[model samples]
Target chain A: MNAIAPSFPAHVQTGALSIRNLSKTYPLKGRPVPVLQGIDLDIRPGEFVSILGASGCGKSTLLRLIVGLDPDYQGQILLDGQPLNGPGLERGIVFQDHRLFPWMTLQQNIALALKNHDLGTAQKQRLVDEHIALVGLRGYEQAYPHQLSGGMAQRGAIARALVNKPKVLLLDEPFGALDALTRVRLQQELQRIWVQERCTVIMVTHDIEEALYLGDRVIVMEANPGRIGEQVQLELAHPRQRDTALLFQHKQRLLAQLVGH
Target chain B: MSPFKALTWLVSPLALLALWAAVADAALFPANLLVPPLEVWRSFADLLATGELQEHLAGSLSRLSLGFAAGALAGLAFGTAMALSDTVEAYCAPLFHTLRQIPSIALIPMLVLLLGIDETFKVVIVAKTAFFPVALATVEGIRAIPRSHFEVAAVYRLRWPTLVARIALPAAVPAIVTGVRVALTRAWVVLVACELLAADSGLGQMIEMGRQMLRIDVVMVGVAITGVIGFALDFSLRRVERRLSGWQVAGR
Candidate 1:
């Protein structure tokens, strides 16, 4: 932990993100099918926002559009009042599947994210090492994704996403595939990483408890034309207890909203 | 390699050899018709010492290498293009499938009639034998790569070359290696058949000459050598293939 670390790229800028009247639609059998519609939201710099919804609710689709994986959408996604186009180094995403290239070692997978950056060899190595440490994967740099357990692989994915020092990190159910124990463990790790790095985070998940656990604000979504239904703000500070009465009340309310009459 | 493993593999072949020696000694068939195992071994030794076996093996291997290289390379390029682009797939898929269905051996007579029983004909037969499985493997490999993998590449904004090298190439390597192994052994078999029918200087030619001269021992030597060479080629390639796709096994 006392290792001298090379600084992030000076050009990297963290910014507040705004999604205004954002709507995405795909043609199904030559008919327009809307996924995300008239979605308006504002996220402060360094805030963690979790969007909650059921399957087909376009929760993942929204994350895809935000990460610039799909550019053919209507409306604005602005970072610091500047419209974002295609994918860039400033935006990083950890998908549900971990998505690490199986042939590459964990270090190579993380190093690959920095391919477009113009850092020196030493700086790149330092950043890769630091992030690997940040996610508590200190000694697993040379392991392949296949050799890792599911939680470790997802952590590798998170390290890869964060190695570029992005302005915003988009996680599409980053811990969706892990067991309940591992998922909860990673949530605590993510909360610590978020506090240390101070970058804006937007994660999409279906779990109500996960939404309230780490998010400063949880955005509940409705399906069949995915759009925001409600928002719950947790004003508690960092490293709050998971079973607090306030969080439990919010979880019950959210559960009703998610799977209720 | 452990001595026990080596001994275990040798057991079956030794049993077959013992059976062969017994049949020859019992004289169920005439000596000329079913040559004794010792006579075959002596002839094999005689050819090796005189370097005739080396000359024939060198000729056969050269043709196999040339033809397999050309065919496999073309198949790889064509298969990748087809997998990547609908236009390429639409144009080439039908013709490619039809050509693959026609076995390389079946084409030997027509090819000999058209191109004559020359080095070119034998090489063409080998190439044809190698092409289909390689192409099919490449296509399946590329197609089998998940959408999730591509999404990761897109998210990172990887350039065209990096995307192909890091993601596409390795992901498809296991299937392509398997395909190449199948093609290599198939091409060797087809090449030997072509040589037996047409060429003047290959293992198949040696066997053909022995048959014509009624020297069953020489022909038996060629048959044994062909089986051993094919087995060695396949075994060697499988090692290479496993190395390339070691990740697949580890993942399981």
Candidate 2:
């Protein structure tokens, strides 16, 4: 915890996540179709891990399982050594679409995520305001989702997810629908926020460059009963430049690996 | 409105009045039967002075309010139950659909025979007219909500009340409001028709009396007033709908 505000407690080293022999299947025509098979991974606290894969690689499914959206899977998911259950405030997720309710203003949307918290009204309001400002949406609190551009709405979603101060943040192709320029800008914003917050993050995406850019470690996945194929540890530091020689090399290697398969 | 747009608004009504005046002047039909626009206007003034038009309007409006309120409330509850529960849907859907298919006018004679040609008959007819559209709208509106919304609700761990009030109801509002508007207009038309058939009061009764006495000017007054009132009802509800759904993305 960098010295910013002493009143706010430092985030404990608590988001360590471990998955062992995780498998999931869906019913199709009354027959079970395997979506994920025998997946095992570990994530350290405050680490950014990106899962890179093709469209049908079950990367999103993996995120959904970890987020506790679907509990019908076969596996053990432990958060800080505790077994997982259904969704809790300890974990937050951002989907491909912003998913903000069109009827609510941005402030109201963010405030809604704090409804379950046992905090004072003023405290919740402060948290909502801080998160909105954190995502660079301070001035547009009154704007509705439909009134916002796609990138701005996604940022609002990020604010809503973070307002709960979840120990882990899951990104399911968070910027997949964005244009190239907006995607690049939002990736940088996400990286900056991650550094400031220092929470565990698992992002699923198909963009190899993005995976290499922000992730401390990138896990490449194979489709057709999705499973881990390869892992690359990036030795680069935060506040990284896009034109770095190391990132270019990693991107080239990742492209060849994905294409060669 | 811009000056040009305001001028465009005047063109249609003005053209209509001019055509009526021209036809009357040409004596295209018997003078009494044609009923010049000025003669109709005089009859309107007489009705207003005698408070006859106000009495009829008040009676019609009160019946509309009572019937619409009862029908809409029942429809809302029933529709929600059918949408949310398979048991209710299994038992009620077929019967509801068949009943809705029969126009309210078709039931007026039978309803009059059973309930007599009184307030009960008019109110029942109006309610029947209001029920189908509202129920249909409620069912479709609630069903139209995307699955993604419920997922978000689950993720947030929203309670049942929060889910219904904050997520479900607001999401379904646009559809529900449209249904209410449709039901309201339809109910008004049916009420008038019922009044024409058997009522002792209301705008429809006024027109019926005008025809019986061969007072073409009085009949013209009733017809014009009904048109104006219907337009006003629709216009106001449309404005309300726009106000409520201002957050929707245009073209979406």
Candidate 3:
């Protein structure tokens, strides 16, 4: 554990991730198909920011770029005032699917991110155990990915992503695969975890309600040369109730904007 | 289930054996050509007592193990390399794929002519038989891994060794195990065929010797033993696969 901190400091006081004038285009056949154009956003340290847009709006693309997963972009992504070249341990991501190794148990899958860390076996086990319990998956350490339900698997994914204790955690519709009820429950859990960990989180989603419920600030993007159309600051206190008047009001407004009402 | 229905399933084999015994007793064929079940069983017992059958079985099994292990390991390495690098895939894929098209059995005649009917020829045949399926499965397996896994690995800044060990190997295990099972079965079958053709001592050679000596009972014993051994080997591998992937079953 002592050696782990020196090799890769998981926690540090850094200006969280910052994206400026970032643009991405896919080469389709021959001509470039522009996905994102001149998108600028800043996720402050310990803030929960959500980017919400309709389908094909490139919200997910922004998250990918921020996490340095797709480095074939045109603009600068900075972390702690450092230029982002590629992925780093300071940034973790959870995709739509669990992406847990099918052959590994829940414990092994969660501990995988720690493999590169200079941690001892006992310390690694402790880290895995802490994250698993944090995600409310305590007893099923030996269970494999296939043994878990969809929501549980995503929780496992969350545990794995957070195990590295990244400065920024990027999520691409992490709860989209779950049922409506499960989605709501997990949203509450995520809010709780974010408050406790104080890790900057940037999530992309199409759900208006989810964006309002989770984001400290929600950025709405428009498709066809994807760009930010509007930004909504939720100004609500932490550990917000699901059916608060403010949540409902913001949800209606965002839904109206999303559905062109 | 009805008791009579269960009884009917047992009757057919008993009836078939009775018919076979009757035919042999009636001397429908020459005594040298058609051996009774009792005679076959006696011959099997005699061989078992003398340890002849065990010696031949052990020899064949050892060859199967060696050839399959060597071939499967090489296949994994080659397949992983091909999947990882475009240069290796582009330059060697066509040639490798073309060679895989030729049936392993078809190469037996040419291999025997080149290397003679020695242990090397038989082992080589087994290795070749095991290689293609395992390699092909491994290539597909590696390709099937989702890009998301790589993204997560990259985000974690996983080192090369850690990425391969933690992400790549575990993700590819199910496919690799499938390939290994295919290789084992292929090697087992090919080794037997090779023994029948050229080996000095093996179950297949024993059957060949029986055929030459006009001992139908001994040949029948060898045939039964081969079938049982093949079934056992395949069944054991299937059990291993189940154990390794048992979490899947539990989830379902």
Which of the two, 1 or 3, has more DockQ?
1
Could you give the DockQ of candidate 1?
0.72
Can you give the DockQ of every candidate in the order shown? 0.72, 0.59, 0.53
lDDT of 3 by residue, A2-92 (tens): 1221111235366477779989999899999999999887777777788888878898888888777787999888887899877777788
TM-score per candidate: 0.91, 0.91, 0.90
lDDT of the structure predicted as candidate 2: 0.89
Using lDDT as the measure, name the better of candidate 1 and candidate 3. Answer: 1
Candidate 1: list runs displaced more than 4 Å: A1-13, A26-32, A243-245, A259-261, B1-6, B113-116
- Residue runs of model 2 more than 4 Å from their true location after superposition: A1-11, A28-31, A235-245, B1-4, B249-252
Global CA lDDT computed for model 1: 0.89
With candidate 2 superimposed using the best TM-score fit, by how many Å does residue A142's alpha carbon deviate from the native? 0.6
lDDT of each: 0.89, 0.89, 0.84
lDDT: which is higher, 2 or 3?
2
What are the chain B TM-scores of all models?
A: 0.96, 0.95, 0.87
A236: Cα error in model 2, Å: 4.5
